[model samples]
Target: MYAMPNNDLEEATPWLDSGEQQVWRRWLVATAQLYRYLDEGLRPHGIDLAEYDVLVHLSEAEDHRLRMGELAGQVHLSRSRLTHTVSRMESQGVVLRRTASHDRRGVVAVLTDEGMALIESVAAHHVRAVRRAFIDAIGRKDLMVIDRSMAAVIAATDPASGPPDH
Candidate 1:
């Protein structure tokens, strides 16, 4: 193997200040832990957070259906990944896909009665998990702070979206 090259460019890095670094590391670990904690609660439901999110969007959609492309964007998943996830859910009889009525070229994912009932059943559990893992942990007084901070981050990161509609 060739020896690694040392360069001044590599040493000229700009790093976070100590306070920011502490918060950044904590935020990283906390997010991972929170996600895993919530996902564990959904384990018996046979779906992870991503699948649950899909179920929720489909359930809230008009006539319980949304075009695949829209679903992918809403869920922050790439089209191919959403297709794969929906395929699996289809096999599990939770969702079904059909060509869009208004747009023949587009496909729509529809939530079945089983899916509706499943989400309704799990919603309470998910809410409890959210409360325990996030809201309660952060406390009510700081909740707005967290929300505002996230909104600012979103505004900065996703200028197209602006403030959250929801």
Candidate 2:
């Protein structure tokens, strides 16, 4: 059997050079700032980005409901994390968790009427914020490139091709 070398860790280093590092650092900063801006925009609606994502996903789901496991996977949250979040939202009348009729072992999370109303009321503001921070800032030509690049990133990070969730 071959033995591992002392320099094994060095082989794991990113391939980025100095210029790539500069570009990557800028991208990281921009990503954080953008998230902060969006979170700030959601403050008035009493929702943060993660909760908003849950709301949006549920709202778009069939009958505004999904299995807890499905919801967690769709929202990219851990099962325990989704349970905690759903519990809080349930207390706020934003959503409800119920036992599945067909499967005793399954739990379903459904957006409540009040939750639907809240999201509907706040959606316009969220859309406007997105437009202001992103769409409005980028030129149409650049936006196309950005869109394509984002799609490529998503494709690359998809479960089948990429490493497990980071």
Candidate 3:
């Protein structure tokens, strides 16, 4: 259990009650375990969660392509990291990098036919994993609660939402 700070200077700041602390700890562990579970499900395809994320974004983009910076942000990878991952995927014939037509200096990531086929084959497995780890565990009645809670979190903290980070 987390103890509330006793310092007079810090006392004004509210600390989590025991119930809140328990919930907070469980949320952290649950998210971590869920991430591991999903990644494990993707292991057979030789791609981790990050690579799978890139493929999913590219698959949904117009013409199966996105500017490198845009894709990096979407996949929550640093530009250099995304570049490295894309390099590995390129070697596997799963993706290709090209100069953006609209901007000579901008790089674009495109999904290859092989990448499409892979996602098509692996998507059902991913969906089932998601259901088993999250949706079914939460059940239909609580889905909206989670949706609203996460939306509030995003609105408060997401840079794209224009909210100042605490």
Query: What is each predicted model's overall lDDT from 0 to 1?
Result: 0.90, 0.88, 0.92
What are the runs in model 3 whose C-alpha is more than 4 Å off? 2-8, 160-166
In model 2, which regions exceed 4 Å deviation? 1-14, 162-166
What lDDT tens digits, residue by residue, belong to model 3 across residues 50-119?
8999999999999999999999999999999999999999998999999999999999999999999989
lDDT of 2 by residue, 10-110 (tens): 56644577788787898799889888998888888888887888999999999999999999999999999999989888988999999998999999999
What value does the lDDT take at residue 74 in candidate 3?
A: 97
lDDT, candidate 1, 97-120, per-residue tens: 999988899999999999999999
- Residue 104 CA displacement from its true place in model 2, Å: 1.4
lDDT for 5 (candidate 2): 41
Candidate 1's displacement at residue 99, Å, is 0.2
Candidate 1, superposed: residue stretches over 4 Å from native: 1-14, 159-166
RMSD of 1: 5.6
- Sorted by lDDT (best first), the order is 3, 1, 2
